[model samples]
Target chain A: MSRRTSRWSVAFVAAVLTSGVGVLLADPHLVLLSIPAVVFAVYPHLTRPPAATLEIERSIAEQDPAHGQEVEVTVTLRNAGDRTLSDVRVVDGVAPMLSVRSGSARHAAVLGPGTETTFSYTVIAKRGVHRFEPATAVLRDASGGVTLETTLAADTELACRSPIRTLPLGHTARYAGSTATTDSGSGIEFSRIRSYRPGDPPGRIDWNRYARSGELTTVSFREERSRTTVCCLDAREICYRSSGDDSVHAVSYERAAARELLDAASDAGEPVGVAIFGVDFTWLAPATGSHHVATAHRTLEDPETLPIVPPTEWDGTPDDAQARELRTRIGPPTTVLLLSPLLDEFPLETARTLRAEGHSVTVLSPDVTTAGSLGRGVARLRRENRIDALRRAGVPVVDWEPETPLETAIRRGERR
Target chain B: MTGPIAIARRLLVGVGAVALCLGLLVLFGPPVESAIRWPWDDELLLVAFFTAALLLASVIGPFVLIDDGSQNQNQNQNRNRNQNRGNASPGAPERVPSTPTPGRELERVLDSRWPASLPPVRRRRIRRRLRRAAIRSIVRTSNCSKETARERLERGVWTDDPVAAAFVRAGGGPDSDSSRLRSLVERIRFPRRARRTARAVLSRTEEGEHR
Candidate 1:
C-alpha cells in the first residue's frame, strides 16, 4: 500500500502566507524568511521512496508439538533487493487457533541491503494442524511520505496432533472387540446340532449321536466376528458452535474424539472407517490394517474433508440426505460412533433415524454449550434436552465436556 | 514523473523557484543607479512584487493548505479496513463466530422491549418458543402428554417459581388480580425475570431427569 503522509503541508501553507504578507508590505526580509519555509515544504518531495523488496521465512521449533505445549516461532526477514528499508513493520501470521504464550509476533526495524532481521514468538500449541498464513510486511520511506505493504509467503505449519488413547465406547464397547453373531459358524458357543455333511470337519461331528442313533450329526457354534465401527462426524455448521469466542469450536473436539475412537478401534484389530457431514458428505469404507488406519487418520486430518474453518454457507443438503448417505454407505451391521455437539435437533433426529435403521448408534457429544449468558444457558438446556432425548431413545449418549478427559466422560456415560 | 500532470507540476516548481529568486534579489540587492530611474520606480517595484506574491499564493496555497475531503475519507476507510484485517493478523487470538442462543431473544425483548413495547408478532414468537421448550421439558420429565404439560404451564402449576410461570405465560391470557400483581413484580424486577424463568424451566427439566 502506497500512501502520501501529506508531510510539511503546514510549512508549505506558512511559506505561502509569509510570501503573501511580505509582498503586500513590500518587505524583502519577510520574503527571505519565507524561503526557509518553502525549502521545508519541498524537501520531502525531493527524495523518492526506497524500493522495498523483502523475503520472510518462518520456522517453528517443534513442528509437531504436544497439546498445550509452548512452541517457539522464528521469523527471518531479508532485504533482498539491495536497497535499505528505513522503517519496516512485520507482523508474522500466526494461526488464529493458537494463542501467543509469550513474546511478540510483531516487530519493527530498519534493514540495510543484504541484512536480515529476526523475531521470535512463542505460541501455545492447540489441537489441530495449524498452518501459518503469509506474514504482513509494511515498509515506510525514510521521509515517512510513502508506505508499502505486501504479504510474504512461507510454507510453515504446526501439526499438533493430540496423542490418542484407548477410550471406553460406553455400552458400545462390544463393537470394540469381536461380537458374537446369531448365525452358526466355526466358534466356541454351540448353536445347534445339524445332520452331518461329508465336508463337515471331523472334529465337529457328534460321534455320540452317531453311536446312539446310528446317524451322523454336526455341532454348530455361534460366529464371533469383529464388527466395523464407523466414526460418523457431524461437521455440520451447527456443530461448529463453541461456548466462547476464544475456545475451540465443538467440531475440533469432535474431531479429536473421532481420531481417538478410530485409533482404539484399529488397535483392537477391528474394521474402522471415517465419515464426515459438513460442506459435503465424505466416506471412508471400513477395513483393518495399518494402511487403513493411516488412511482414516489422513481423512480426519484433511481440511477439505473436515475443515477447521466453519462453513460460511450451509451445503443446503438437509441432515436427512447425509443420514441417508451414511446409512447406505454403512450397512446395518456396522456400528455408528457419532461425534456431534448436539447444538440443534438435527443430530438427535439423525441418531434416532440411524438407530431405527438397525445400526447400533452411540452418540459422543462434546458439550460446547456454556452458562455465560441467559441465552447461552438456554442453549445449554436445549442441548441437554437433545442428549436426554437420545439417551431415552436407547442410543447411549456420552456427553463429553472438552475441559474433562475424554475417558472420564465415556466412563460417566457408561455409568449412566 | 513522466505524466503530463507531473510535467506541469515540475514546470510550476521551476517557475516558482525563479520568481522567488528574482523577488529576493529585487528586495535585498543594491538599488539600480541607472539614469532612467523614475520617481515612481519604488512604487512600481512594490506593485510588481505584490502581484507576484498574490499569484504564488493563489497557485500553491490550495495544494498545501487545504484538506482533500476525498483523501480524508479514503484514509478513514483504510483505517477501518486495517482494524478489520488486524482481527485475523498474526498473534490475534482465534475467534469463532458465535451463534445466537435461544435465551438471547428473550433477553433482548426483556431488556429492550418491556411490557407492551414489543411487536405482538415477535413477542408471541418468543413466547411460543419458550412455552414449547418448557412444555417439552415438562413432558420429558413427567412422562405426560404435551397438552397436559401446556395446560399446567398456562395454569402456573408447572413450577413453584411464580415469576417464571408468569414470564412464560406472559400475554397468554386474561390478567387476574394475582397474575397482575406478579406482572407488576415482574416489571419491577424486569430484565432478570426472563433469565429466572429460563432457570426455572431448566430446573424443572432437571427435576424430572432425576426422577
Candidate 2:
C-alpha cells in the first residue's frame, strides 16, 4: 500500500504555523484559529486504512461455446480481515478478440470484514481458442489516502468449433476408382443380360430367360472400383467477396466443399489430393487415408495457405507454365474437382486448360456475386457467361449460391 | 485544490475570532484596573487574561464542533452502508465499497479501447491501423491477397492515388509528424475520386499560372 498526505493534513500544518507566528507576536486571535487545524490534522490519523485482507475469485459460465455464442463471466471479491475496506475496484481480464456483448466487466464496492461483492458480464465468443488473463483488484482506505493494487490469477480457456458441414458426392466417377462405376461388371447392382461367352461363369447365367428361350445368357452387374481424384480450390483474391453476413467468403466455401469431397473420396478408399491456387500455389499429391484427409483439412483451414486477401495483380493468363505445373503434379486416372468463385476469366481459362489436358473436370463455383448494384450486376453477368462457356466445353459446372449449403447444391447439380 | 469560497470562509472565521478576543479584552479592562495598583499593569493583566480565555475557547470550541460533526457523519455513513447491504442479493458476500476514481476510470477506458497488441506508441498504432485498412481496401478493390497488396503499395502501383503509398513511406513515428497526414488520408471519402479531383485541381492551377 502507498500513502500520500491529504489536503486536510496540509491545511492543518499551515494553520499550526500561522498560530505559532501569531503567538510569537503576542496575538491571541491567531491561537484561536489554530484549534480547527489541529483537529483536522489528527482526525485522519485516528482512522487509517487497515492491513491487506482481500480475496478474489472468478468463474465462467461456459468453457467452450459455439462460434458467435455469448458467454457470461462473474468475478467475486471478499474481505476477510477485521477492518472495513471502504473502497475496492475489480477489472476482469477478458480476451482481446472476444467482445463484451452486455454488462460491464468491472465493479466497485465498499466492504467490512467478512463482507463480499460480485460483478458479472457477457462476451460474444469468436472462432479459435481463447484464454482469459488474471483479474486486477485495487483497494483503498476510507480516507482515500492509501491504495493497494494486486492481480488475482484465474486462467481459463474457451474453444469454439468450426461452423462448416461436410459435403456429399455423386456416384459417377470420370476416371477408374474403387467407388461404384456406371459401367457394367461383376458387382452388387444388376446391369443387363448378354450373350454368354465360353469363359462366362455359370453363376452369372440367366437360367429363367435361358429356359424360356432355350438359349445360354449371362447377367451383368455394375462395376465397383476406386478412382484417383484431385480437389483444387481457388484462393484468388477475387474469391474473397461475400454477399451476406451469414455467408462466408467464396474462398472459405470453396475450402469447405473441397474438404468434404476429399473426405468422401478418402472414405471410399480412393486416392485423393488437394491443390490451392492464387495467393501462393500449394499442392498435395493424390493419396487416400485418414492421415491424408486430416492433412487436407489442416491445409484448407490454414489462413496462410489460403489467404483471405486477393493478389494485387494477375500473375498472367492461364499459360503453358500453369498447365505444365498441373500436368507434373496430377497424373492420369485422376478426376479434378475445381472449386472457385469464377469471378474472373483466369479461373475459367484454367478450367478449360485442365479439361484440354484430358482430365475429367467439374467446376464447383461458389456464387458470391449479387445483383444489388449495377457493378455487381455486370460482374454477375460476366460470371454467368463464364459458367456457360465452361458448360459449352463439356465441363460440368455447379454454380453454388453463397447462401446454399454445399451438399444440397452438389446433389441438385448431380441430378441435372 | 480548495475553492475560493472555502478560503474566504476560513479567513472570515479568523478575523471574527480576533475581533471577539479584542472585544472581551476591552470589556474586562476597567475591572482589572480597579484591582491593580499600577495603571499599565492593569492593561497587561487584562490582555493576559483575554489571551488565556481566547486560547481556552480556541481549543474547546473546535473539540465540541468536531465531536458533533463526526457523530453526524458516522450516523450517515452507517445508514449508507446498511442501504448498500440491503441492495445486494441475500447470502452474497460482503463488499468494501468506494466511489470510482475519475482518473483511474479514464485509464481503464484507454487501456481497453486501444489496441494493446499493436505498438504502444500512438503514431505507430495509427500507422499500423491505417496501413492495414488501406491494404484491406486494396485487396477488396483490386481482388488481391495481403501479400500482393503490400507489394503493390510498396511499388507505388496506385500512382493515380499517391496518398496511401506516401503514407506508407512517411517514416516519422512521432504523433506530431504523422497525425496530420493520417487525418488527411482518413478523411478521403472515396480514395479514387479524391485522387482524380486532386489531379484535376493541380492541372487547373497549373494552367491558370501559365496563362
Candidate 3:
C-alpha cells in the first residue's frame, strides 16, 4: 500500500493542468503542448508488483569440512509467478564469522516467469558450527517507482571439525603407553628377585631361580602406575598476545597443546582434567571415560567457556585468591601440566607456587614472542628468563616454538 | 548534436528561417501581388505554401539523418570496446597498474605467505595484521589521521586496484569480504590453477621500481 510520487509525474501534471486551464480561458495555442504531459503521467501506473510468487533454494558444497577449508554456498531463486521481474536484487545471508573466499553472495538480474537465477560464494570454514540466515530479495518494477522487499528463508548448516592429534607427553606420564614411564613396575622389563612370601602369586614364584639357588624367591617387577595429569591453561589477559596472526595467539597454542595432552593422557588410561583460569574460570575435575572426554570437548568448543580475547591486563603481581582457588582444585597426587605463554611474571610465580606445594609441575610455554622489533625482543628475552628461572626451580619446562608440532616439542623438551 | 531535442531545435530553426524569408518575399516581391490578383481564387496561394513547406523539410532532413547515423556508429564502437575489456585475458597488460607506488607498501604487507588452506583462525589473524599494517602505511604516506586513512581505505580511496583495496578493507576477520580477499591472495600467490598469473604480473614490472 506504500506509494511514492514520481517527481517527473508531479512536475508534468502540474505544468499540464496550469497550461490547459490557461489555454481554455485565454490562449488556445498552449493546448497542444499539454498532450505530452498527459502521456507522461500515465507511464508510471503501467508497472506492477510482479506477482508474489518466488521459490528460493539454498545448497552448500560441504556440510562438514576441515578447519581452514573453503565451502561454497549457492542460492537458486526461481520466478514461480506468471510475470516477468525486471529488476531483482538478491543478497544471501552469510554467516558473520565465515569469510567469503571467492565469488559473490549477491546478484542482480531480470527473471521472466519460470526462469531461474543463482548466486554463490565461497566461505572459509572456521572451527565450530555455523548456520545460514535467510536471503533478502528486493523486487523493483520497470518504472523504478515500486519496490517490494521480501525475505526468503534458507536453512543450511556448515560444521568445521578440528582433527585431534596426539601430543607427546615425553617422560612426564609414567604409564604403559607410547611414552615410557620412569618408575617401571609390572611391565615388560625384569627388575629383581626377592624372598618369596607365603601369599605370593603362583605366577610370580621364580621356579627356575629356586631350582638354581635352592632358596625360595619370588619374581618382582617394577609396578607401572598410570599418571594422573591436570592440564592448567593460563587464559589470562597477558596470555592473549599474538606474534602475528590471531591463530598464532598464545592462548590458541596453549589450548591446542592442552587438547593434545588430554587426548594422549586419556588414551593411556590416565585420569586427565582441564582448568582454564581467566574471566571464564572453567574447571573440569580429574576423571577418565568416554563421557569425560566428551565433556572436555564440549567445554573446549563452547565459546562461553573459553577466553578468545583478554578480559583484563596482567600487572605481573600475584593474586592470592586465584592461587588459593587453583590449589584447592588441584589434588596433590596429580601432575600439573601448566600450559601458558608466560607473557608476564604472574604465570611464572604460579608455576613456582604449584611446584612448592609438592605437585609435580610440567610447564609447556608456547613461544609467541618475536624479536623483529626492540619491544618484542625485550618481551622474548623476558619470556626466556622466566623459562630459565622455572627450570632452575626444578620444574620441567617445555619452551615450544609455534612452528614445531606440540608432540615434537614435548619430546624434544623431555630429551633435554 | 544527435539527440532528439537537438534535432527538434534544428527543425524549428529551419522552419522559422523559411517562414521569415517567405514573409519578406511576400511583403516586397511582385509574386505576392500576382498571386493575390489571380483569377483562380486561392490556388496560387496554396501552391506557394506547399512549396515553402517542402523547402524547409529538404533543408533540415539531411542533418537529422547524418546525426542519427553518427550516433549509432558511436554506440557500436563503445559496445565493442566494452566487450574487449570484458574478454581481456588474465595476463592482460591493462589489468596491471600503471604506477603502483601508492599500493606498494600495502602490497608488500599483503605479500606475506597466507595460504587459504591454513585454519580460518590463522587466516583471519594474518588478514588483520596485513590490514592494520596497510592502514598504518596509508596514514604515514598520505599524511592523514588513522581514522581518515581507515575510512578512505575502507571506501577504497587510496588505490585503484580493487583486489589491493579489498585486501585493506577486509581486515582480518570472518567476514565474507575478508575471506574472499584471503582466498584471492592465496590463489594469486600460489596459483594452483592460474599459476602464471602472479608470474606474469610481477615479471612485467621491476621490483624496486615500485618503491
Candidate 4:
C-alpha cells in the first residue's frame, strides 16, 4: 500500500471520471483508462469497516487458576462507529501460549452501526506474561470492494505468572558457622546456653544445672547442615501438555511448577539446579545456580522456545535423544523432578533412568486426555497404571489431572 | 435502507432500462422488415428516418424523468457535480515506472518464460532498469551471471538478464571487447524478442529495480 497508495488514489478518481465523462461524451475510447482502473479496483478487497472508535471490555472468569485450571476470557467488542460491519475477526492474545480450548476465539460477526458483538473465548491459564496485541480489525465494503485493515488500539493485556506449588521440605537446614553466643532454636550442634524463658521447651532445660543454680536456664544448640540437594527439571515436552479443559498451554504451568520447586528447595538451603531439555537441534544445558534460576525464569516466561531459538518449521515431535542425554547428566543423590503431559515416552524413560540411578525421582505427569471421555477414558486409566508401575519400581509419582492444584498432588504424594 | 425506496428505485431503474433498450432496437437494430413485403408500403427511406428518430430518442430517453413518486430530474446533474471521488481514479504520477531493482527482475524472469524487449514507458524506467542490471552483474557476478564478460566484470546483474547483457555487450553500454563477448552469450540465451529485467542498481547504493 505504499507507492500504490498514490496510484490508487489517482486510479479511483480517474476511473469514475473517465467512465462518467465517457458516457456523457458518448465516446468509448475513454475505456482505455478503465483497464488500469479495473486493476486498481481489484486491490481494495471487501472487509468489515474499521472499528475506529470501538469500546473493548475484557474479563476473566476468576482471579486464581488452579494448576491446570481453564478460564474463559469474555471479550465484548462494541462497535461504536456509525456504520455496519461485516466479517469481524477477533483474536484474544492470552498470556503464555494457551490456545482457546472450546469456544471460538476468532469470530466473524455482522453488526449494524452502533451495535456491539460480545465474543466469549475460553483460555486456560499458563505461567508468564500473556500480552494481548491490539485486536486486528478488518472491514470491507459490501461489493467486496474497498477494504480497510486497522488494529484496534484499545487492547487489554492480562499477565498471569503464577507460582508453582512446592511440598513442605521434610527438614529445613541452616548454615551460619558462627561462634558468637546467641539465643536461638536448638540443634545437635551447641549454639549457646541462656537463662530459661517461660515459653522455653522443657527438653532443653538442662535439669542438673537448673537444680544447682536454682534458676531456669535453657541450652541452645547450633543448627545442623545436610547435603546440598540439586533438583534437575526434565522439561523437554511442554508443547504436548494438555489440560483438563483440553488446552495445550499447560506446558507453561509445568515451567511455573519447576520454578516454584526451586524456590521451595532453596528455602530449605538445598542448592538447586534447573535444566530445560529438548529445545532445538542442540539442546541447551543451562548450568544450575542462582543465575540458572534466573535463566530458567526467563525461559519459563515464554510458553514456546523462550526465545531460545526463533521458531522453525517444527514437526511437533519430541526430541527423545536430547531427553536421554539430559537423563544421563543427572548429578548424584539429586532429586529428579520430571514434569510432562504423558503424551509421549521421552519423559517416562527419564524418570525411570533417574530411579534406576538411585536418585529420588518425583514425577508430575499432567494428564492430557482426549475430549468427551470416549477414546481418552481407557487410555488415561492405562497411563495412570503405568505411572503406578513406575512408583512400584521405587519412584514417587504425582498424578496431575489438569485443573487439580499442585497442593492436591502433594497431598496425594504424602498419602502414598 | 427500506423496501419502498429500494422498490421505487428498482422500478424506476427497470423502466428506464427497458425504454433505453426499445430505443436502441429502433435506432441501432437493422431494419430488415422494411425490405420485406408488408401491409403498409415498406419504404426504405421511411424506415431509415424512423431509425434516426429512434436513435435521437434513445439518447434523450435516459435523461427523461423517472417516476417513483419522486423526481430524478436533477439526479444525473447532481451526480455530475458531486461526482463520487471514492469511485474515481486519482491523478498521481507512476512511481517505480519499473519494478524494484534486480531481485524483482530475476523473480519475474524466472517466473515467466524469457521474452523480448521490456515494455517501454518512461526513459527513467529504462535507465533505472539498465543501471540496476549493471549493479546486479557487478555484485552477484560469480553466482548470478558469467563473470568473465567485461560487462559482467563490471557488474553481474546486468549480465544476468540475457537481453541486458547482449545490449551492453554489443557495444551498447560499455565499449570493451570482453563486454562484447559477454553480449554474445546473452543473445545465445535470450531470443531477440525475449527481454530480461534490467538490474541497474550501481549508481545508487539503495536497493531498487535490478535485473
Q: Which residue pairs of candidate 3 clash?
A: A100-B176, A100-B180, A185-A222, A185-A223, A185-A224, A186-A222, B128-B172
Q: Which stretches of candidate 2 lie over 4 Å from their true place?
A: A1-225, A244-247, A309-323, B1-211
TM-score of each: 0.65, 0.40, 0.44, 0.43
Error of 2 at A177 (Å): 5.0
Least accurate 10 contiguous residues by lDDT in model 2 chain B: B90-99
After the best TM-score superposition of candidate 1, give how far the Cα of residue A102 lies from its true spot, in angstroms: 5.5
User: How accurate locally is residue A110 in candidate 4, as Cα lDDT from 0 to 100?
Assistant: 72
Candidate 4's TM-score reads 0.43
| Model 3 docking category | incorrect
- DockQ, each predicted model: 0.23, 0.02, 0.01, 0.01
Candidate topping lDDT: 1
lDDT of 4 by residue, B112-162 (tens): 455433332322343343443343334332333333434543443433355
- The alpha-carbon lDDT assigned to residue B192 of candidate 3 equals 27
Off by over 4 Å in 4: A1-61, A65-90, A94-134, A139-165, A168-188, A191-246, A249-253, A266-270, A279-294, A303-324, A327-332, A343-345, A356-358, A370-378, B1-211
lDDT of 4 at A253: 51
**Tens digit of lDDT per residue, candidate 4, span A249-330?**
3354565566566665554445555555544422234343567566655655543543211233445445776666555655
lDDT of 1 by residue, A309-358 (tens): 55456646677787788878876566888888887677788888877878
